[model samples]
Target: MNKRSPLDRHKQIRARLARRLFVVRGWLVLETVWRAAWPVGAMIGAYFALALLGIWEQAPAFVHLAVFGLVLLGGAGILWHRLRRAIWPGDADARRRLEESGGARHRPIDAVFDAPAMAAGASVLWRRHRDHMAETAQDLPVKAPRLSLVYEDPRALRAIVLLALFIGALYAGPDAGRRLFQALQPPFGDAPRTVVLDAWLTPPDYTGKSPIVLHGPITANKAHDEAAAPLSAPVGSMLVVRLNGGRQAPVLLAGEDDIPFDTVGTVDHRLEFALSDPDLSVLEIRQGGRSRALWPLALSPINRRASALSEPPLKVVGKPCG
Candidate 1:
């Protein structure tokens, strides 16, 4: 045999390496497809489940169905081609002969040896490729797509919903407003408003008796006379008024002896009666027994004035809140 140059030996090594690399690349592509395809298949399965469960409104069900169909068809076609070669030795031979000029060039045992050797050489290349890929991945940075104000945030959606509600209410106007208010019931039945306090009011400077005053317009008919004595604290009364000023005031009526109130700890705003007389007025009040000076005792009708003029301007109400 003729002496071979070092450069020729190197070229031979490179040619063998290139052939092995081609095989390795085919395997890598196959593995990559297999790995990627499963997740897509899983995603498709999940989307199909969501569609069946009736939760596909968020993302169109048909899109997922179509993707699944296309991927299945593509994968099936690729698998069928690979299986055709694997299944029939004659088919593989014919294809190999057609590609390589009419002769069956290699022996079966030669292929077995070459296959293992190619795999071993490819393993080295695969390790290098993996290292290269890791280095490449380190060099790159991941980035997310930018979204404008209304596209991606829940707050924006909430704002839109609120705006829609306000517009709807504005269109429906007063009747809707009244219905909305009427629909809401107070925490307690319309009980006469009463407040509980930690202490009672101070006695007037001159008189030793603790004083209490009733404010608000007194109805001419419901003057709260002695005949209507022992007035029951009716339901639906709200403790609308509060008194923090004036330490001392005139007590409405004085009992002969030191009453349960005087003997007990400071009496908060509550019903009181003289020990001698059981028949007495039961006035509802704030913590210090002060009345709401703002509104009258009874609501007045606005027959003389228009409804719009009688009431304040309507306002948009938000989602039902307590």
Candidate 2:
């Protein structure tokens, strides 16, 4: 009826509506993505805080939380698909949409133009009506008026705020920020243990010489002095060993010699045992029937002078190591 093509006019108006619908749908999707990120960010921030505080002794719950977050995000993605389907308009649906969105001028005129489009086949009057619709579509503005459908939602804005806050908190604390995504580990390691065992060898009256005293624990399969010095003594020297300290006692004493260390002297908070030799390895100490730890010691004769010597397994009698 007019200079402009009717078919193209119908198509143009439909395309504009579809484009607006698409934009609205895209906005919904973007909003969904934004909203989904909030809870996920909250969960992630919580994990960082917990890890920094060393609160994950039993099992880290973040794995489950992250899974839940992914599920929530997946739900949003699925909703996006549903929203798209709703936004897409069929031919009949487009007819109704055109009528509703006809605006002021076309609003006064009845929607006879879209009547043929709603049906499968065209009638004699269909061309005339379609042409009129084309003219009407041309008169309307290019920009559609359903912008309200595509505006950012308040919920989405709130979600963005929450996400931003969570992200900011993650970086605010250096201790927490550095610990994110790091493996959870125990805080403490084995503490350094210091056990001191001291011993002395005194010759019997027959081979009498002054007693030689060594102060220190035996370790590495050898009885050693505190300064790691050597001991020189003749054979058959009575070994008098005294292990000082409340925590370094031995349940059973052992050595290469396998000689018996007899209980000899006792003082306040001290017990003296006569050892056959100065070389011994502490097998284990049992407190209340529970075996504890074991260490090594080495001992042998030396010249009158003590010198740094090679370490060896000791053979000393039972001496109260404590």
Candidate 3:
């Protein structure tokens, strides 16, 4: 008998590997589908529970809502696929056995096939599955969702590390002060700042002579001068910035956007020009035909500073502020 050459052996090995890979791939898909079913079912239950509890507080806004919706849809599809396979009548042996077994005498395999009997069996199985899942999940503390670098792709890890180093240099280097460059931006783009030079500031509707008239209800008072140290209101409030230049007109600001208006003593010959407070920064300065264009202020400063002792705002700016 002629012995197989090295090439022949290699080709044979490759063929076996290919067959094994195919089998593994098939098994992986089946396992993934099977495992995903329980999670999907649990999510469905949780979704309903959340709805009942009216817990939409932390739910994502518009963009995240869409993303979560797609995720749920994908989960639903996986669950449906798994359910179909689990309940499918394709397995001839299983189907035969299911048919032969008398209803209530033994557990039903597919409820769709024999509704009444399957329903009873399903109730029992559902109860067991629910209890099992609950007991298992009880001890496992809820994990804060986070990106685990351990599972990250090598290339992505390298790129992120490189980017982070590049960012670090901007802060670590001598040119750190350059980070405050964003502060030079105009409060409103190309819009001249309106100097309210009136003695009696009348807000929209002109109901009161108060310098500020908040249209919205105050929701949360992280800090305030009011009697309630931290007054929280369901509705948001409006902050009226009283103008001093003969203009009594008050600049109405939504409380939601207003950071604690820190009195920065005096700056640029004005005691209260709404000096660039570190707590608040201008988001956008849109110009309009009206006398007073809204200066969209952000509660968190873009170039937020940090302290060794305190938890500072996540700094987007590269360097330390002077």
Candidate 4:
């Protein structure tokens, strides 16, 4: 077997120590970043969750501004506090830490860079000491850095915030991100209350048909663009309109007449009428003097002849009439 020369052995030992030092340095940086940024991340997540759940939209403009300011200030303060106490490990510090973790009793890593004294006998001693240190460092242990923020959040509030964000995202559907941005904007006047408009056609009990929804609970701004399909219901069916949480009562415009909705509550309105007008070809719902939704009505006359034909023919049971 070819034995390594003293110079080669020295190079190998130094290289190994350098790699350990690099790892320690990286972990130190990572720890510092985590400690400083975790609180800020948690704050941001909680804010986003509220936005996604539409809590901000329901609040006044002042409340939105207040929340924004609080988040900004809290984040800044947390970062400043954590960063002020953060210690950025230098090369020497990294080397010391690595040696300590490896359970080195003597300062082996320091000896690697120590210079020999000028005295003649000191050179031999220094060389022997470095060799011993190299031997001890051969099986050095490197432990992973402590990156958990459990101590900072003892009550596990961060986990709750994460859960809220997930739930809110699902509840908000595809418009989750859009709702967040909308919540950030402080409205000029009082925040617009969410309006729910539900309108459907209920066929007569004799017709044996389920109620057909003409418009689901859509917001006021999108009602016109998101109108449901044209309504085709049998004549004598009842058209029911329910408007909830709107500032003004809703109006039903069928043909030329404008029928006002009956008050149901402080902000609830309901209208129900029989669809007997065969000439009526369209229906419209108006709120605050603006058309919210329009549906083309196609009323089909009941077919009595078809109903009769669907029944079994009268049975002629009389055996061979006389």
Candidate 5:
């Protein structure tokens, strides 16, 4: 029986590395998609829910979210390709070490990674390396390594754990979760450095209202001294402004006789203010006198749509005076 040469053994190792490289790269992409896809989906779902719940139906907001999701995924693909190529399987030195774990006892696979399809014109140095491989071949009966150097990696369990939690929270109360999702968004302007505000604008149950949250409502660190959206309620109607996650002192604020905001709590302020007159009001969040945020309030007549026109056709009593 003819003995197969060391070249054959080296070739075999290279082939194995190539195959293993594919495995590693595929796993990386799978892991990245696994981690990125769901959160993106959750965010999009939450945004849709908020829109349906009458939070804000501006198309641009959803457009920005879609662009962001595509960008994240596109960049992930580019990074995955780059990372895969970083491992040069063609390097004979690397291949030898790879097989070394499989029982290539000596550094016999030195040029395994660098060797060309066939070693070109033989120099003394080249011949010496070749001769070493040839001699080493005698020891390798089948050149099959005892164990594969590469191990398979799967999706991260930690990410999966967090994903489960996020999903649970999302289902438990989508409206409540909407606030957190909002904060995760990129701030529009130069937002505050470290803090986040999760505010919920809950409509009064009498108004058949459910809770709607605005996460990262104040994304900009230095936000305008005004509310993002106007809070409108008819006279005698109630509005609940629940603020969470702020490093500021809270005070039961009264805005100059403009229907006092009888709020609750200090650190995390939950301002439950009632409407009386058809006047404007504001809810300001001030902490350390540095961070300040405002929420506008609009009061409507007790019967917003109720009018004399609805009571009875207008009376032409003016003619009697004439």
Candidate 6:
């Protein structure tokens, strides 16, 4: 077996050390970035959570502007404060760290690249010392980067923010993404106009049945395609309709008649009618001459049956009894 020359041995040692230095430098940069930007990440997560929960929509325009500005300023301030004193690891710094990471006391990595003095160049002891340092540098160990920010955030606020974001996302359903985008829009922009309609069927007092909700805040879908099931109500039940936030008053279409809603307030309209006609099969609500809702009506006739004595109270003529 041929042995490696001193020059080849030096090259091998330098190559191994160079690779370790590269890795350590990368890890140092990643650690610095994490420490500087984690706070911003946490803030963004909390903001998104609120948006998903629809808190932004309920807040006023001024509140929206204030919150948006606060997030930007706070994020910038955090990044600047954390990065101002950050010292990026250079090649030399990485090399030093790599050597110290292995708990070496002899400073072997430094000695391998150092040139011997003129007086020490001829000494056999110096050559042996250099050989030992080169051998030690061959198997240097690099530790994983210190990326955790627990020391900076002793309260673990990031975890809490992540939890809130997760819960809000789940509660928001498939509309969470759209809501998030909406939350980012300018507060002064023209918002979409929505009309609210509430309709219910209330049975007469003698029927003793609870009112049935035909349309309400939760079931109001402008794009719903599936036809609503026919509603079965006792005869004489009152059909109450309340429309709010519409540009025009809503009208009730029963058979061929066009019944208009009574104006209650500037934007509120109400309609109340008895479901007495058995021939009325369908009811439709219209606004601006466009059908908003349709409900098939099935009126159930009131049950009225009289009880009669079956056998004339079981004549006891048998025994005037003992």
The backbone clash count of each candidate, in order, is 11, 12, 12, 0, 10, 0
Which candidate has the top score in TM-score?
4
Q: What is the C-alpha lDDT of each candidate?
A: 0.34, 0.42, 0.34, 0.77, 0.47, 0.76
Task: Point out where model 6 deviates above 4 Å.
Answer: 1-3, 116-123, 186-188, 191-322
Tens digits of per-residue lDDT for model 4, 73-175: 9899988988888887799878777878888877888787566566876777778878888888867878899888888778988899999999999977765
Q: lDDT tens string, model 5, 36-107? A: 444344444554444333233123455545655665676566556645554433335334434544476655
Which is superior by TM-score, 2 or 4?
4
Query: Candidate 5 at residue 41, lDDT?
Result: 44
Candidate 3 vs. true structure, TM-score? 0.19
User: What is the descending TM-score order?
Assistant: 4, 6, 5, 2, 1, 3
Worst 10 residues of 5 by lDDT: 144-153
- lDDT per residue, candidate 6, 1-322, as tens digits? 9998987888888888888878999988888888888989998889889887767755766787688888889899989988987777787777778888887767887778777675744767776788898888878898999978889789999999989998988977765766677667636543432456788999866666799998633223434423556678877789998875444677888888889999753346799988878778788887765667777778887554311322235555665656
Which pairs of residues collide in model 5? Answer: 91-113, 92-112, 92-113, 92-114, 93-113, 191-220, 191-221, 192-220, 192-221, 227-294
> Model 3, 1-322: lDDT tens per residue?
9998644654454444344334444444454454446555445444433322222212323433454465478777877776666632234333333233322223222322232435645877754544443333222222222333333243444444445445544433432222222112112333333232211212222222244322211221222323232222111123334322111222333333422222221110111233223333221111122233233333323222322233445757687779
Q: What TM-score does each of the candidates earn?
A: 0.20, 0.28, 0.19, 0.58, 0.33, 0.56
- Candidate 6, overall lDDT? 0.76
Candidate 2, residue 147: how far the Cα is off, in Å: 14
The predicted structure with the larger lDDT, 2 or 4, is 4
Instruction: Find the 10 residues in a row with the least total lDDT in model 4.
Output: 216-225
Full-model lDDT, candidate 3 = 0.34
Query: In model 4, which regions exceed 4 Å deviation?
Result: 45-54, 80-85, 116-118, 148-294, 303-322
lDDT score, candidate 1: 0.34
Put the candidates in lDDT order, highest first: 4, 6, 5, 2, 1, 3
**Which segments of model 1 are wrong by more than 4 Å?**
1-118, 138-157, 160-200, 207-281, 285-322
lDDT (tens digit, per residue) of candidate 1 on 171-232: 43433333233222111322222222322222222233344333333221234332342322
Give me the runs in candidate 2 sitting further than 4 Å from their true place.
1-4, 12-20, 28-177, 183-322
